[model samples]
Target: MEGAPQGTGYVVNLDEKLGRIDEHWKPRVVAQMNDYQFKLVKICGDFVWHSHADTDETFFVIDGEVRIDLRGGPVVIRAGELFVVPKGVEHKPYAEHEASIMLIEPCGVLNTGDARNERTAQNDMWL
Candidate 1:
């Protein structure tokens, strides 16, 4: 990972970091602050419905568009927009085409949240 040297916070180019990812739904850690981590991922199609019990999940759309389905309704997030899924609220994200996004959440939070299944990704993987 090419990052800024110690004592000097460097810049992380979102487009550049996102280009390295090829698989959908696999989040790669790009940066971290305290106990929170920033992850980049490419997503397509529908995701499993799940919720984080202890923490909220933030999604920043970088490219394309995404639809987050909630019990109450659905929210559409386009490029350069962001959305936060409240803690314990079930949400499923979907995209008609491939989309690049960043997820900000506490360290060790599972991608599948409480719905662990074949879609669960390994945690703390750095880019």
Candidate 2:
């Protein structure tokens, strides 16, 4: 209600969109600009270690905390914090508890980047 879109252009409520997500590791599209898309996902446990060769990946934490394991060290991102993993840099995302996050990246970028496995999620899922 409070964050619901008004009678105008698209106005997304991140909380409202996040409430619809029922699974971990699956990202659902919420908004798109130019050739990029804004995605929301709930994460827990560990994600695959991977990298995007053609584009950078952005992670914005909305709730709880996230730890990104990079070669240099682990970067912790709390709610309201954002981090960008540069293109071709391998990283892994992990959360001890469930965390809501937004990912900003170009369309067609796989969730697992170049690594494909049981952890790889379908592309272009919208909420």
Candidate 3:
């Protein structure tokens, strides 16, 4: 099925389509545009502490639990919960167990925030 001219494409059997992603610490782009994109990431362990100086990033917990360490405090988000980190706020995300998360942000958002370590993935790998 085709997508609407001004909307995201119609998703048919998302669970079936997403069954291909099984690795940890890898993200897959589900949709994109000139300035923004939607990504699904499988996370476990501690990510780097960093900040996005130009754009806010939104994270929605799809499964399991995730803990976001902010500059002054920490927020634990479970499945169905969402959080937004405004631009320039130093934060680190971690999950003791495997967690699936969806991120909404401007295109070119560095997965590793500002750290730019080897964990930073460059390709816009689509699922």
Candidate 4:
């Protein structure tokens, strides 16, 4: 198996990686565990409504807060907290200001699910 750097197989500084990003809604792959990928992204304003039909998505807040608008209601995820949006559940994510967050999901999952558009980012993008 391929090992990582720093003699620990992996050592990703989330703060450092987050500082390198300036775009919104674009997730940068930071690490991989088995078949899953851990991505860091900066979010603000409103995101497109979408859902992962095949797999659930875990949204973990690193800084600031995130609000996910679901058909039933809205789910607020604060810093140091996490929320999982189940597969096939239509939802839209929103953040008042720039929010640093991490998304844990299987590799190759699209940022925008069924609502593909210009906001859809290419899979497997690393920082």
Q: Could you tell me every candidate's TM-score relative to the true structure?
A: 0.93, 0.93, 0.86, 0.92
lDDT of 2 at 123: 91
Q: Is candidate 2 or candidate 3 better by lDDT?
A: 2
TM-score of 1: 0.93
Q: Rank the candidates by lDDT, best first.
A: 2, 1, 4, 3
Superposition error at 49 for model 2 (Å): 0.5
Return the clash pairs for model 2, or none: none
lDDT of 2: 0.92
Better of 1 and 3 by TM-score: 1
Against the unseen true structure, what C-alpha lDDT does each candidate score? 0.92, 0.92, 0.80, 0.90
lDDT of 2 by residue, 1-127 (tens): 2343323358889998898899999998888888888999999999999999999999999999999999999999999999999999999999999999999999899999999999999998877
lDDT of 1 by residue, 24-102 (tens): 9999888888889899999999999999999999999999999999999999999999999999999999999999999
User: What is residue 16's positional error in candidate 4, in angstroms?
Assistant: 0.9
CA RMSD, predictions in order = 2.4, 4.0, 3.8, 3.2
How high is the lDDT of residue 27 in model 3?
70
